[model samples]
Target: MRKPRRGAVILLIVCLFFLPSCEAIDNDFSIWDKLFNPVWDGDFSSLNYKATYPENNVTSGGNMEAWLDIVGWFNMSRINGTDYIYGDPANQSITEYNAIDTLGWNDNMDWIKHELLYDVVNDTLIVQDNITMLWHHSEEKTTSEGHTYIQKTYYYSYLTVYDSEIIPKQYVYDGQNIEALITFYNNSINPKSVIFIPDKLGLYSIDYTYKNESVHEDLMTGYVENNSKGIEFVNFTYNSGWSDPGGNLSHIGVCAVVKGGNFTPDNLSIDIYTPYEQLNITNYNLSTCNLFKGERSMHILLFPILLIIFSPFLLIYFIYKRAGR
Candidate 1:
Protein backbone atom coordinates (compact mmCIF):
# COMPACT_ATOMS: atom_id res chain seq x y z
CA MET A 1 0.00 0.00 0.00
CA ARG A 2 2.82 2.43 0.86
CA LYS A 3 4.63 1.63 -2.40
CA PRO A 4 1.49 2.22 -4.49
CA ARG A 5 0.88 5.58 -2.74
CA ARG A 6 4.43 6.69 -3.50
CA GLY A 7 4.01 5.69 -7.16
CA ALA A 8 0.75 7.64 -7.34
CA VAL A 9 2.49 10.80 -6.14
CA ILE A 10 5.18 10.37 -8.81
CA LEU A 11 2.53 9.98 -11.52
CA LEU A 12 0.75 13.16 -10.44
CA ILE A 13 4.03 15.09 -10.64
CA VAL A 14 4.62 13.71 -14.11
CA CYS A 15 1.15 14.79 -15.20
CA LEU A 16 1.81 18.30 -13.93
CA PHE A 17 5.10 18.44 -15.84
CA PHE A 18 3.51 17.59 -19.21
CA LEU A 19 0.53 20.00 -19.35
CA PRO A 20 0.35 22.58 -22.18
CA SER A 21 1.98 25.89 -21.25
CA CYS A 22 -0.75 28.05 -22.77
CA GLU A 23 -3.36 28.37 -19.99
CA ALA A 24 -5.85 29.77 -22.52
CA ILE A 25 -6.11 26.50 -24.45
CA ASP A 26 -7.52 24.43 -21.55
CA ASN A 27 -9.47 27.20 -19.83
CA ASP A 28 -12.79 28.89 -20.64
CA PHE A 29 -11.23 31.13 -23.28
CA SER A 30 -12.97 30.80 -26.66
CA ILE A 31 -10.87 29.33 -29.46
CA TRP A 32 -10.91 32.79 -31.01
CA ASP A 33 -9.44 34.33 -27.87
CA LYS A 34 -6.86 31.59 -27.43
CA LEU A 35 -5.58 31.77 -31.01
CA PHE A 36 -5.34 35.57 -31.18
CA ASN A 37 -4.17 36.19 -27.63
CA PRO A 38 -2.26 39.53 -27.74
CA VAL A 39 0.46 38.08 -25.60
CA TRP A 40 1.71 36.30 -28.71
CA ASP A 41 1.81 39.49 -30.74
CA GLY A 42 4.88 41.65 -30.43
CA ASP A 43 4.89 45.20 -29.03
CA PHE A 44 1.27 46.35 -29.32
CA SER A 45 2.34 49.11 -26.96
CA SER A 46 1.17 51.67 -29.55
CA LEU A 47 -2.45 50.41 -29.64
CA ASN A 48 -2.53 50.26 -25.85
CA TYR A 49 -4.25 53.46 -24.76
CA LYS A 50 -6.32 54.72 -21.82
CA ALA A 51 -8.75 56.90 -23.75
CA THR A 52 -10.82 56.52 -26.95
CA TYR A 53 -13.21 58.94 -28.67
CA PRO A 54 -12.10 61.85 -26.48
CA GLU A 55 -14.43 64.11 -28.46
CA ASN A 56 -18.20 64.22 -27.58
CA ASN A 57 -16.86 62.95 -24.27
CA VAL A 58 -16.97 59.38 -25.60
CA THR A 59 -14.74 58.34 -22.72
CA SER A 60 -17.67 59.64 -20.64
CA GLY A 61 -19.16 56.14 -20.91
CA GLY A 62 -16.28 54.02 -22.32
CA ASN A 63 -15.11 52.68 -25.71
CA MET A 64 -15.21 49.48 -27.73
CA GLU A 65 -11.48 48.79 -27.72
CA ALA A 66 -9.75 47.12 -30.71
CA TRP A 67 -6.10 46.91 -29.71
CA LEU A 68 -5.41 43.97 -32.01
CA ASP A 69 -8.61 41.99 -31.54
CA ILE A 70 -11.24 44.72 -30.93
CA VAL A 71 -10.80 44.17 -27.18
CA GLY A 72 -14.38 45.01 -26.06
CA TRP A 73 -17.41 46.74 -27.59
CA PHE A 74 -19.19 49.94 -26.53
CA ASN A 75 -22.97 50.54 -26.55
CA MET A 76 -22.83 49.88 -30.38
CA SER A 77 -23.00 53.24 -32.15
CA ARG A 78 -22.71 52.23 -35.85
CA ILE A 79 -21.28 55.49 -37.17
CA ASN A 80 -19.76 58.75 -36.11
CA GLY A 81 -21.65 62.06 -35.98
CA THR A 82 -20.59 65.66 -36.04
CA ASP A 83 -22.36 69.04 -35.84
CA TYR A 84 -23.23 68.32 -39.48
CA ILE A 85 -26.75 66.89 -39.14
CA TYR A 86 -28.35 65.28 -42.20
CA GLY A 87 -31.92 64.41 -43.30
CA ASP A 88 -34.92 66.65 -44.06
CA PRO A 89 -37.08 68.45 -41.49
CA ALA A 90 -35.38 66.37 -38.76
CA ASN A 91 -32.00 64.69 -38.31
CA GLN A 92 -31.99 60.86 -38.69
CA SER A 93 -28.57 60.05 -37.24
CA ILE A 94 -28.16 58.48 -33.83
CA THR A 95 -28.99 61.22 -31.31
CA GLU A 96 -29.59 58.93 -28.33
CA TYR A 97 -26.67 56.55 -27.63
CA ASN A 98 -25.11 54.34 -24.96
CA ALA A 99 -21.42 54.40 -24.02
CA ILE A 100 -21.28 51.56 -21.54
CA ASP A 101 -19.68 48.17 -22.20
CA THR A 102 -21.70 45.07 -23.14
CA LEU A 103 -20.60 43.05 -20.12
CA GLY A 104 -21.80 45.86 -17.89
CA TRP A 105 -25.41 45.34 -19.06
CA ASN A 106 -27.53 42.18 -18.87
CA ASP A 107 -29.24 43.04 -22.16
CA ASN A 108 -30.08 41.32 -25.45
CA MET A 109 -26.66 42.08 -26.99
CA ASP A 110 -24.88 39.20 -25.32
CA TRP A 111 -21.12 39.72 -24.98
CA ILE A 112 -20.53 36.21 -26.25
CA LYS A 113 -22.58 36.66 -29.44
CA HIS A 114 -21.18 40.09 -30.34
CA GLU A 115 -17.60 39.29 -29.40
CA LEU A 116 -15.08 39.64 -32.28
CA LEU A 117 -14.37 36.38 -34.06
CA TYR A 118 -10.74 35.73 -34.99
CA ASP A 119 -9.84 35.01 -38.61
CA VAL A 120 -6.63 33.04 -38.21
CA VAL A 121 -5.57 33.17 -41.86
CA ASN A 122 -5.60 36.95 -42.14
CA ASP A 123 -5.48 37.87 -38.45
CA THR A 124 -8.78 39.70 -38.66
CA LEU A 125 -11.95 40.00 -36.55
CA ILE A 126 -15.47 39.32 -37.85
CA VAL A 127 -17.64 41.77 -35.91
CA GLN A 128 -21.26 40.66 -35.47
CA ASP A 129 -23.92 43.23 -34.51
CA ASN A 130 -27.70 42.81 -34.30
CA ILE A 131 -29.62 45.16 -31.98
CA THR A 132 -32.85 47.23 -31.94
CA MET A 133 -32.88 51.01 -31.83
CA LEU A 134 -33.54 52.84 -28.54
CA TRP A 135 -36.83 54.64 -29.29
CA HIS A 136 -38.13 51.44 -30.83
CA HIS A 137 -36.99 49.31 -27.87
CA SER A 138 -39.88 50.58 -25.70
CA GLU A 139 -42.81 48.18 -25.23
CA GLU A 140 -45.19 50.92 -26.32
CA LYS A 141 -44.92 52.46 -29.77
CA THR A 142 -46.48 55.47 -31.49
CA THR A 143 -45.45 54.50 -35.04
CA SER A 144 -48.01 52.83 -37.36
CA GLU A 145 -45.60 49.95 -37.74
CA GLY A 146 -46.93 47.00 -35.69
CA HIS A 147 -43.68 45.52 -34.36
CA THR A 148 -42.32 49.03 -33.61
CA TYR A 149 -38.75 48.08 -34.68
CA ILE A 150 -36.72 45.49 -36.50
CA GLN A 151 -33.26 44.04 -35.85
CA LYS A 152 -30.86 44.13 -38.78
CA THR A 153 -27.68 42.13 -39.09
CA TYR A 154 -24.63 44.37 -39.09
CA TYR A 155 -21.37 42.52 -39.60
CA TYR A 156 -17.92 43.72 -40.70
CA SER A 157 -14.33 42.60 -40.87
CA TYR A 158 -11.30 44.34 -39.38
CA LEU A 159 -7.61 43.54 -39.89
CA THR A 160 -4.92 43.66 -37.20
CA VAL A 161 -1.60 45.21 -38.20
CA TYR A 162 0.08 43.24 -35.44
CA ASP A 163 2.01 45.87 -33.47
CA SER A 164 0.38 48.83 -35.24
CA GLU A 165 -3.42 49.28 -35.40
CA ILE A 166 -6.54 47.62 -36.80
CA ILE A 167 -8.29 48.81 -39.99
CA PRO A 168 -11.35 47.95 -42.08
CA LYS A 169 -10.21 45.45 -44.72
CA GLN A 170 -13.36 44.32 -46.47
CA TYR A 171 -15.25 47.66 -46.52
CA VAL A 172 -18.60 45.87 -46.35
CA TYR A 173 -20.36 48.43 -44.12
CA ASP A 174 -21.68 50.46 -47.08
CA GLY A 175 -23.93 47.59 -48.13
CA GLN A 176 -25.27 47.56 -44.58
CA ASN A 177 -26.46 51.17 -44.85
CA ILE A 178 -28.25 50.34 -48.10
CA GLU A 179 -30.15 47.51 -46.38
CA ALA A 180 -31.21 49.79 -43.48
CA LEU A 181 -32.34 52.52 -45.88
CA ILE A 182 -34.43 49.98 -47.81
CA THR A 183 -36.11 48.84 -44.57
CA PHE A 184 -37.02 52.36 -43.37
CA TYR A 185 -38.26 53.38 -46.85
CA ASN A 186 -40.19 50.15 -47.49
CA ASN A 187 -41.89 50.27 -44.10
CA SER A 188 -42.56 54.04 -44.47
CA ILE A 189 -41.35 54.62 -40.90
CA ASN A 190 -39.26 57.47 -39.56
CA PRO A 191 -36.00 56.27 -37.99
CA LYS A 192 -34.09 57.73 -35.08
CA SER A 193 -32.32 61.09 -35.24
CA VAL A 194 -28.92 61.01 -36.96
CA ILE A 195 -25.80 63.04 -36.24
CA PHE A 196 -24.07 63.63 -39.56
CA ILE A 197 -20.38 62.83 -39.15
CA PRO A 198 -18.32 64.99 -41.55
CA ASP A 199 -14.87 63.56 -40.79
CA LYS A 200 -13.97 62.56 -44.32
CA LEU A 201 -12.28 64.77 -46.95
CA GLY A 202 -15.30 65.62 -49.11
CA LEU A 203 -18.34 64.48 -47.10
CA TYR A 204 -21.76 65.51 -48.43
CA SER A 205 -24.95 64.64 -46.54
CA ILE A 206 -28.18 63.90 -48.40
CA ASP A 207 -31.13 66.12 -47.41
CA TYR A 208 -33.03 62.93 -46.67
CA THR A 209 -36.52 62.41 -45.19
CA TYR A 210 -38.44 59.37 -44.03
CA LYS A 211 -38.72 56.69 -46.78
CA ASN A 212 -36.69 58.77 -49.25
CA GLU A 213 -34.07 56.51 -50.89
CA SER A 214 -33.30 58.56 -54.00
CA VAL A 215 -31.76 61.50 -52.08
CA HIS A 216 -29.43 59.22 -50.07
CA GLU A 217 -28.62 56.99 -53.06
CA ASP A 218 -25.94 59.37 -54.36
CA LEU A 219 -24.30 59.57 -50.90
CA MET A 220 -24.29 55.80 -50.58
CA THR A 221 -23.33 55.14 -54.22
CA GLY A 222 -19.80 54.20 -53.14
CA TYR A 223 -18.28 53.83 -49.67
CA VAL A 224 -14.84 55.11 -48.76
CA GLU A 225 -12.73 52.13 -47.77
CA ASN A 226 -9.61 54.17 -47.27
CA ASN A 227 -9.70 57.72 -46.00
CA SER A 228 -6.44 59.08 -47.50
CA LYS A 229 -6.59 61.87 -44.94
CA GLY A 230 -6.96 59.05 -42.41
CA ILE A 231 -10.25 58.47 -40.60
CA GLU A 232 -10.73 60.38 -37.36
CA PHE A 233 -12.94 57.69 -35.83
CA VAL A 234 -16.04 55.59 -36.63
CA ASN A 235 -19.05 55.05 -34.36
CA PHE A 236 -21.91 52.51 -34.37
CA THR A 237 -25.09 52.76 -32.27
CA TYR A 238 -27.30 49.78 -31.31
CA ASN A 239 -30.06 49.28 -28.74
CA SER A 240 -30.52 46.50 -26.18
CA GLY A 241 -33.52 45.89 -23.92
CA TRP A 242 -33.12 46.07 -20.13
CA SER A 243 -34.38 42.64 -19.07
CA ASP A 244 -34.08 43.33 -15.34
CA PRO A 245 -35.87 46.65 -14.66
CA GLY A 246 -38.12 46.12 -17.74
CA GLY A 247 -37.45 49.21 -19.87
CA ASN A 248 -35.25 50.48 -22.65
CA LEU A 249 -31.53 50.48 -21.86
CA SER A 250 -31.08 53.38 -24.23
CA HIS A 251 -28.59 53.10 -27.12
CA ILE A 252 -24.90 52.12 -27.24
CA GLY A 253 -22.48 53.47 -29.84
CA VAL A 254 -19.17 51.67 -30.15
CA CYS A 255 -16.41 54.08 -31.17
CA ALA A 256 -13.17 52.94 -32.84
CA VAL A 257 -10.91 55.88 -32.16
CA VAL A 258 -7.54 56.20 -33.86
CA LYS A 259 -4.78 56.31 -31.18
CA GLY A 260 -1.94 58.44 -32.63
CA GLY A 261 -4.31 61.30 -33.45
CA ASN A 262 -2.37 61.49 -36.68
CA PHE A 263 -5.45 61.95 -38.85
CA THR A 264 -7.96 64.75 -38.54
CA PRO A 265 -10.79 65.44 -40.94
CA ASP A 266 -10.39 68.36 -43.36
CA ASN A 267 -10.40 70.78 -40.42
CA LEU A 268 -9.76 74.53 -40.61
CA SER A 269 -8.25 74.83 -37.15
CA ILE A 270 -6.25 71.56 -37.37
CA ASP A 271 -3.43 70.90 -39.86
CA ILE A 272 -4.49 67.84 -41.87
CA TYR A 273 -1.22 67.53 -43.81
CA THR A 274 0.93 67.70 -40.69
CA PRO A 275 -1.15 65.01 -38.98
CA TYR A 276 -1.26 62.89 -42.11
CA GLU A 277 2.52 63.08 -42.48
CA GLN A 278 2.88 61.99 -38.86
CA LEU A 279 0.94 58.78 -39.57
CA ASN A 280 3.06 55.64 -39.23
CA ILE A 281 2.26 52.19 -40.56
CA THR A 282 4.16 49.42 -38.81
CA ASN A 283 4.98 46.02 -40.31
CA TYR A 284 2.42 43.42 -39.25
CA ASN A 285 3.11 39.85 -38.05
CA LEU A 286 6.86 40.46 -38.22
CA SER A 287 7.73 38.47 -35.11
CA THR A 288 6.64 35.11 -33.76
CA CYS A 289 3.78 35.01 -31.26
CA ASN A 290 4.60 35.41 -27.58
CA LEU A 291 4.14 31.79 -26.45
CA PHE A 292 4.96 30.12 -29.74
CA LYS A 293 8.35 31.77 -30.28
CA GLY A 294 10.67 29.77 -32.57
CA GLU A 295 12.13 26.43 -31.36
CA ARG A 296 11.35 27.34 -27.76
CA SER A 297 7.67 26.91 -28.60
CA MET A 298 8.25 23.45 -29.98
CA HIS A 299 9.98 22.42 -26.75
CA ILE A 300 7.18 23.85 -24.61
CA LEU A 301 4.50 22.17 -26.70
CA LEU A 302 6.40 18.87 -26.72
CA PHE A 303 7.29 18.95 -23.04
CA PRO A 304 4.22 16.98 -22.02
CA ILE A 305 4.71 14.24 -24.59
CA LEU A 306 8.27 13.66 -23.41
CA LEU A 307 7.18 13.59 -19.78
CA ILE A 308 4.42 11.07 -20.46
CA ILE A 309 6.84 8.71 -22.15
CA PHE A 310 9.37 8.98 -19.29
CA SER A 311 6.85 8.76 -16.41
CA PRO A 312 6.69 4.95 -16.35
CA PHE A 313 10.45 4.62 -16.27
CA LEU A 314 10.67 7.30 -13.59
CA LEU A 315 8.10 5.42 -11.46
CA ILE A 316 9.96 2.10 -11.82
CA TYR A 317 13.22 3.70 -10.86
CA PHE A 318 11.69 5.26 -7.78
CA ILE A 319 10.21 1.93 -6.75
CA TYR A 320 13.60 0.19 -7.14
CA LYS A 321 15.26 2.90 -5.07
CA ARG A 322 12.63 2.59 -2.32
CA ALA A 323 13.01 -1.20 -2.19
CA GLY A 324 16.80 -0.91 -1.98
CA ARG A 325 16.36 1.50 0.90
Candidate 2:
Protein backbone atom coordinates (compact mmCIF):
# COMPACT_ATOMS: atom_id res chain seq x y z
CA MET A 1 0.00 0.00 0.00
CA ARG A 2 2.85 2.45 0.78
CA LYS A 3 4.65 1.66 -2.48
CA PRO A 4 1.44 2.15 -4.50
CA ARG A 5 0.74 5.51 -2.75
CA ARG A 6 4.30 6.71 -3.46
CA GLY A 7 3.93 5.78 -7.16
CA ALA A 8 0.60 7.66 -7.34
CA VAL A 9 2.18 10.86 -5.93
CA ILE A 10 5.11 10.63 -8.36
CA LEU A 11 2.72 10.06 -11.25
CA LEU A 12 0.64 13.07 -10.29
CA ILE A 13 3.75 15.29 -10.13
CA VAL A 14 4.97 13.99 -13.47
CA CYS A 15 1.63 14.72 -15.14
CA LEU A 16 1.68 18.27 -13.80
CA PHE A 17 5.20 18.80 -15.04
CA PHE A 18 4.58 17.30 -18.49
CA LEU A 19 1.46 19.32 -19.20
CA PRO A 20 1.90 22.07 -21.82
CA SER A 21 2.56 25.51 -20.44
CA CYS A 22 0.67 28.68 -21.35
CA GLU A 23 3.99 30.38 -22.20
CA ALA A 24 4.60 27.83 -24.98
CA ILE A 25 1.14 28.45 -26.41
CA ASP A 26 1.83 32.20 -26.48
CA ASN A 27 4.67 32.09 -28.96
CA ASP A 28 4.72 35.24 -31.09
CA PHE A 29 4.70 35.27 -34.89
CA SER A 30 8.37 35.46 -35.90
CA ILE A 31 7.63 36.09 -39.60
CA TRP A 32 5.54 39.19 -38.99
CA ASP A 33 8.08 40.47 -36.49
CA LYS A 34 11.00 40.09 -38.91
CA LEU A 35 9.07 41.84 -41.68
CA PHE A 36 8.63 45.00 -39.60
CA ASN A 37 12.16 45.02 -38.17
CA PRO A 38 13.44 48.53 -38.81
CA VAL A 39 16.96 49.49 -39.83
CA TRP A 40 16.61 52.99 -38.38
CA ASP A 41 13.50 53.42 -36.27
CA GLY A 42 14.25 57.04 -35.38
CA ASP A 43 15.46 60.00 -37.45
CA PHE A 44 18.51 58.36 -39.01
CA SER A 45 17.22 59.29 -42.46
CA SER A 46 16.56 62.95 -41.48
CA LEU A 47 20.09 63.39 -40.27
CA ASN A 48 22.61 64.14 -43.02
CA TYR A 49 24.48 60.89 -42.40
CA LYS A 50 25.32 59.30 -45.71
CA ALA A 51 26.77 55.79 -45.44
CA THR A 52 29.55 54.62 -47.74
CA TYR A 53 29.41 51.19 -49.43
CA PRO A 54 31.73 48.60 -47.87
CA GLU A 55 35.37 49.80 -48.02
CA ASN A 56 36.46 46.77 -50.06
CA ASN A 57 33.25 47.05 -52.13
CA VAL A 58 32.19 43.71 -50.61
CA THR A 59 28.41 43.36 -50.37
CA SER A 60 28.45 41.75 -46.90
CA GLY A 61 31.39 42.77 -44.67
CA GLY A 62 30.22 40.84 -41.57
CA ASN A 63 29.99 44.21 -39.84
CA MET A 64 27.30 44.70 -37.23
CA GLU A 65 27.37 48.47 -37.62
CA ALA A 66 26.74 48.22 -41.35
CA TRP A 67 23.80 45.81 -40.91
CA LEU A 68 22.31 48.01 -38.21
CA ASP A 69 22.46 51.15 -40.34
CA ILE A 70 21.62 49.68 -43.77
CA VAL A 71 19.10 47.01 -42.86
CA GLY A 72 15.52 48.35 -42.88
CA TRP A 73 13.17 48.41 -45.88
CA PHE A 74 10.53 51.01 -46.78
CA ASN A 75 6.95 50.30 -47.82
CA MET A 76 6.59 49.98 -51.56
CA SER A 77 4.46 52.69 -53.08
CA ARG A 78 1.75 52.00 -55.69
CA ILE A 79 2.86 51.27 -59.26
CA ASN A 80 2.52 54.97 -59.93
CA GLY A 81 3.40 56.95 -56.84
CA THR A 82 4.88 60.39 -56.13
CA ASP A 83 7.12 59.40 -53.21
CA TYR A 84 8.26 56.38 -51.21
CA ILE A 85 6.52 55.67 -47.92
CA TYR A 86 7.75 53.71 -44.91
CA GLY A 87 5.69 50.62 -44.06
CA ASP A 88 3.55 50.63 -40.93
CA PRO A 89 3.27 47.42 -38.94
CA ALA A 90 -0.37 48.07 -38.08
CA ASN A 91 -1.31 48.58 -41.72
CA GLN A 92 -0.44 46.64 -44.88
CA SER A 93 0.87 48.54 -47.91
CA ILE A 94 0.08 45.96 -50.55
CA THR A 95 -3.15 44.14 -49.80
CA GLU A 96 -2.66 41.24 -52.21
CA TYR A 97 1.08 40.97 -51.96
CA ASN A 98 2.52 37.77 -50.48
CA ALA A 99 6.00 37.67 -48.99
CA ILE A 100 8.50 35.38 -50.72
CA ASP A 101 9.67 33.86 -47.46
CA THR A 102 9.46 30.09 -46.88
CA LEU A 103 6.76 30.08 -44.18
CA GLY A 104 3.13 31.23 -44.34
CA TRP A 105 0.74 32.88 -41.87
CA ASN A 106 -0.23 29.50 -40.32
CA ASP A 107 3.45 28.43 -40.20
CA ASN A 108 2.74 25.91 -42.94
CA MET A 109 5.29 25.83 -45.80
CA ASP A 110 3.38 26.75 -49.01
CA TRP A 111 5.89 28.76 -51.06
CA ILE A 112 6.35 25.99 -53.62
CA LYS A 113 2.68 26.05 -54.62
CA HIS A 114 2.70 29.83 -54.85
CA GLU A 115 5.80 29.70 -57.03
CA LEU A 116 4.18 27.37 -59.57
CA LEU A 117 0.87 29.24 -59.67
CA TYR A 118 2.22 32.82 -59.82
CA ASP A 119 6.02 33.10 -60.07
CA VAL A 120 6.30 30.70 -63.01
CA VAL A 121 4.03 32.50 -65.53
CA ASN A 122 4.48 36.11 -64.42
CA ASP A 123 8.12 36.20 -65.49
CA THR A 124 8.43 38.17 -62.29
CA LEU A 125 8.22 37.50 -58.59
CA ILE A 126 4.67 38.50 -57.68
CA VAL A 127 4.61 39.29 -53.99
CA GLN A 128 1.02 40.21 -53.06
CA ASP A 129 0.03 41.25 -56.60
CA ASN A 130 2.74 43.92 -56.54
CA ILE A 131 5.81 43.00 -58.54
CA THR A 132 9.12 42.86 -56.69
CA MET A 133 10.93 45.91 -58.11
CA LEU A 134 14.39 45.23 -56.77
CA TRP A 135 15.74 42.00 -55.30
CA HIS A 136 19.11 42.12 -53.48
CA HIS A 137 20.48 38.64 -52.76
CA SER A 138 24.10 37.48 -52.13
CA GLU A 139 25.76 34.36 -53.63
CA GLU A 140 29.04 32.63 -52.69
CA LYS A 141 32.03 32.98 -54.98
CA THR A 142 33.71 29.86 -56.36
CA THR A 143 36.57 30.72 -58.79
CA SER A 144 39.00 33.66 -58.69
CA GLU A 145 37.44 35.41 -61.71
CA GLY A 146 33.86 35.20 -60.46
CA HIS A 147 34.28 34.89 -56.71
CA THR A 148 30.83 36.33 -55.89
CA TYR A 149 28.25 38.52 -57.48
CA ILE A 150 25.40 40.37 -55.80
CA GLN A 151 22.40 39.93 -58.11
CA LYS A 152 19.85 42.77 -57.99
CA THR A 153 17.20 41.74 -60.51
CA TYR A 154 14.44 44.30 -61.02
CA TYR A 155 10.87 43.26 -62.01
CA TYR A 156 8.65 45.78 -63.81
CA SER A 157 6.05 43.72 -65.67
CA TYR A 158 2.65 45.44 -65.37
CA LEU A 159 -0.75 43.89 -66.16
CA THR A 160 -2.76 46.72 -67.64
CA VAL A 161 -6.47 46.21 -67.02
CA TYR A 162 -8.87 48.03 -69.38
CA ASP A 163 -12.66 47.64 -69.50
CA SER A 164 -12.42 44.85 -66.94
CA GLU A 165 -10.24 42.91 -69.34
CA ILE A 166 -6.59 41.93 -69.00
CA ILE A 167 -5.07 43.56 -72.10
CA PRO A 168 -1.62 42.81 -73.42
CA LYS A 169 -1.48 39.68 -71.16
CA GLN A 170 1.96 40.84 -69.99
CA TYR A 171 4.26 43.70 -70.98
CA VAL A 172 8.01 43.73 -71.02
CA TYR A 173 9.20 46.37 -68.55
CA ASP A 174 11.63 49.08 -69.67
CA GLY A 175 15.12 47.83 -68.87
CA GLN A 176 16.58 51.33 -69.46
CA ASN A 177 14.71 52.82 -66.51
CA ILE A 178 15.75 49.96 -64.21
CA GLU A 179 19.38 50.18 -65.35
CA ALA A 180 19.62 53.76 -64.07
CA LEU A 181 19.09 52.52 -60.52
CA ILE A 182 22.06 50.09 -60.82
CA THR A 183 24.49 52.94 -61.69
CA PHE A 184 23.87 54.51 -58.27
CA TYR A 185 26.16 51.80 -56.73
CA ASN A 186 28.35 50.31 -59.50
CA ASN A 187 30.68 51.67 -62.23
CA SER A 188 30.45 50.81 -65.94
CA ILE A 189 33.92 49.68 -67.06
CA ASN A 190 32.78 46.40 -68.58
CA PRO A 191 30.58 45.91 -71.68
CA LYS A 192 26.77 45.52 -71.53
CA SER A 193 23.96 44.02 -73.69
CA VAL A 194 20.11 43.99 -74.03
CA ILE A 195 17.21 42.33 -75.96
CA PHE A 196 13.62 43.50 -76.33
CA ILE A 197 10.40 42.63 -78.20
CA PRO A 198 6.85 44.03 -78.51
CA ASP A 199 3.88 41.70 -78.36
CA LYS A 200 1.73 41.79 -81.48
CA LEU A 201 -1.09 39.69 -79.95
CA GLY A 202 0.35 38.34 -76.67
CA LEU A 203 3.42 39.01 -74.42
CA TYR A 204 6.91 40.30 -75.26
CA SER A 205 10.24 39.62 -73.54
CA ILE A 206 13.05 42.01 -72.40
CA ASP A 207 16.64 41.26 -71.28
CA TYR A 208 19.56 43.63 -70.55
CA THR A 209 23.09 43.42 -69.10
CA TYR A 210 25.41 45.88 -67.28
CA LYS A 211 28.99 45.63 -65.93
CA ASN A 212 30.38 46.28 -62.42
CA GLU A 213 32.16 49.47 -63.54
CA SER A 214 31.92 51.43 -66.77
CA VAL A 215 32.36 54.99 -68.03
CA HIS A 216 30.03 54.87 -71.05
CA GLU A 217 26.37 53.76 -70.78
CA ASP A 218 25.24 51.62 -73.71
CA LEU A 219 21.67 52.02 -75.01
CA MET A 220 20.88 48.96 -77.19
CA THR A 221 17.13 48.43 -77.67
CA GLY A 222 16.32 46.10 -80.59
CA TYR A 223 13.05 45.01 -82.26
CA VAL A 224 12.21 41.47 -83.38
CA GLU A 225 12.90 41.63 -87.15
CA ASN A 226 12.06 37.93 -87.31
CA ASN A 227 9.84 36.17 -84.75
CA SER A 228 10.67 32.69 -86.09
CA LYS A 229 14.29 33.15 -85.05
CA GLY A 230 12.97 33.81 -81.49
CA ILE A 231 15.35 36.82 -80.93
CA GLU A 232 17.41 39.20 -83.05
CA PHE A 233 21.15 39.14 -82.24
CA VAL A 234 23.12 42.40 -81.81
CA ASN A 235 26.86 42.43 -80.97
CA PHE A 236 28.69 45.69 -80.19
CA THR A 237 32.06 46.59 -78.56
CA TYR A 238 31.56 48.34 -75.19
CA ASN A 239 33.90 51.34 -74.86
CA SER A 240 32.62 52.72 -71.55
CA GLY A 241 34.75 51.82 -68.50
CA TRP A 242 34.35 52.52 -64.78
CA SER A 243 36.71 52.29 -61.75
CA ASP A 244 36.62 49.29 -59.41
CA PRO A 245 38.74 47.97 -56.50
CA GLY A 246 38.20 44.36 -57.70
CA GLY A 247 40.28 45.29 -60.84
CA ASN A 248 38.07 43.65 -63.54
CA LEU A 249 35.05 45.83 -64.31
CA SER A 250 33.29 43.97 -67.11
CA HIS A 251 30.18 41.75 -67.60
CA ILE A 252 29.35 39.19 -70.25
CA GLY A 253 26.41 40.19 -72.51
CA VAL A 254 23.49 38.04 -73.77
CA CYS A 255 19.79 38.46 -74.84
CA ALA A 256 16.77 36.51 -76.24
CA VAL A 257 13.87 37.47 -78.59
CA VAL A 258 10.27 36.59 -77.74
CA LYS A 259 8.34 38.37 -80.47
CA GLY A 260 8.88 39.93 -83.97
CA GLY A 261 7.34 42.65 -86.19
CA ASN A 262 8.07 45.01 -89.12
CA PHE A 263 9.23 48.71 -89.24
CA THR A 264 6.67 51.46 -88.36
CA PRO A 265 3.39 50.13 -86.95
CA ASP A 266 5.28 47.59 -84.79
CA ASN A 267 6.96 48.22 -81.40
CA LEU A 268 10.65 49.00 -80.80
CA SER A 269 13.03 47.14 -78.46
CA ILE A 270 14.54 49.50 -75.85
CA ASP A 271 17.41 48.71 -73.39
CA ILE A 272 20.34 50.53 -71.68
CA TYR A 273 23.42 49.86 -69.48
CA THR A 274 25.58 51.54 -66.77
CA PRO A 275 27.65 49.60 -64.17
CA TYR A 276 28.92 50.39 -60.66
CA GLU A 277 32.53 51.61 -60.64
CA GLN A 278 33.30 52.34 -57.00
CA LEU A 279 31.39 49.53 -55.23
CA ASN A 280 33.21 46.31 -54.42
CA ILE A 281 31.66 43.10 -55.78
CA THR A 282 32.21 40.85 -52.80
CA ASN A 283 32.15 37.08 -53.28
CA TYR A 284 29.37 35.94 -50.99
CA ASN A 285 25.82 34.56 -51.06
CA LEU A 286 23.33 37.17 -49.92
CA SER A 287 20.64 34.72 -48.76
CA THR A 288 22.85 32.94 -46.22
CA CYS A 289 25.01 35.86 -45.04
CA ASN A 290 23.18 36.05 -41.73
CA LEU A 291 23.38 32.26 -41.32
CA PHE A 292 27.18 32.14 -41.77
CA LYS A 293 27.54 34.34 -38.67
CA GLY A 294 25.31 32.19 -36.38
CA GLU A 295 22.37 34.50 -36.95
CA ARG A 296 19.49 32.43 -38.35
CA SER A 297 15.72 31.95 -38.42
CA MET A 298 14.75 29.82 -35.42
CA HIS A 299 11.65 28.67 -37.33
CA ILE A 300 13.86 26.72 -39.74
CA LEU A 301 15.05 24.22 -37.11
CA LEU A 302 12.24 24.56 -34.58
CA PHE A 303 10.56 21.23 -35.32
CA PRO A 304 13.72 19.12 -35.12
CA ILE A 305 14.81 20.77 -31.89
CA LEU A 306 11.39 20.28 -30.35
CA LEU A 307 11.42 16.59 -31.26
CA ILE A 308 14.70 16.13 -29.40
CA ILE A 309 13.38 18.06 -26.40
CA PHE A 310 10.23 15.91 -26.11
CA SER A 311 11.86 12.51 -26.69
CA PRO A 312 12.44 11.95 -22.96
CA PHE A 313 8.69 11.83 -22.36
CA LEU A 314 8.39 8.71 -24.52
CA LEU A 315 11.27 7.03 -22.63
CA ILE A 316 9.61 7.78 -19.26
CA TYR A 317 6.27 6.38 -20.50
CA PHE A 318 7.94 3.12 -21.57
CA ILE A 319 9.78 2.81 -18.24
CA TYR A 320 6.54 3.29 -16.32
CA LYS A 321 4.82 0.56 -18.38
CA ARG A 322 7.72 -1.88 -17.75
CA ALA A 323 7.65 -1.19 -13.99
CA GLY A 324 3.87 -1.73 -13.85
CA ARG A 325 4.34 -5.16 -15.53
Cα lDDT listed for each candidate? 0.26, 0.25
TM-scores, one per candidate:
0.15, 0.11
Highest TM-score against the true fold, candidate: 1
Model 1: worst 10 consecutive residues (lDDT sum): 179-188
In angstroms, the error of model 1 at 57 is 47
Could you give candidate 1's per-residue lDDT for residues 120-209 as a string of tens digits? 234233432222212112133445665565443432222222211132322222211121111011111212221122232222122222
Angstrom error of the Cα, residue 75, model 1: value is: 21
RMSD of model 2 against the true structure: 35.9
Which TM-score value belongs to model 1? 0.15
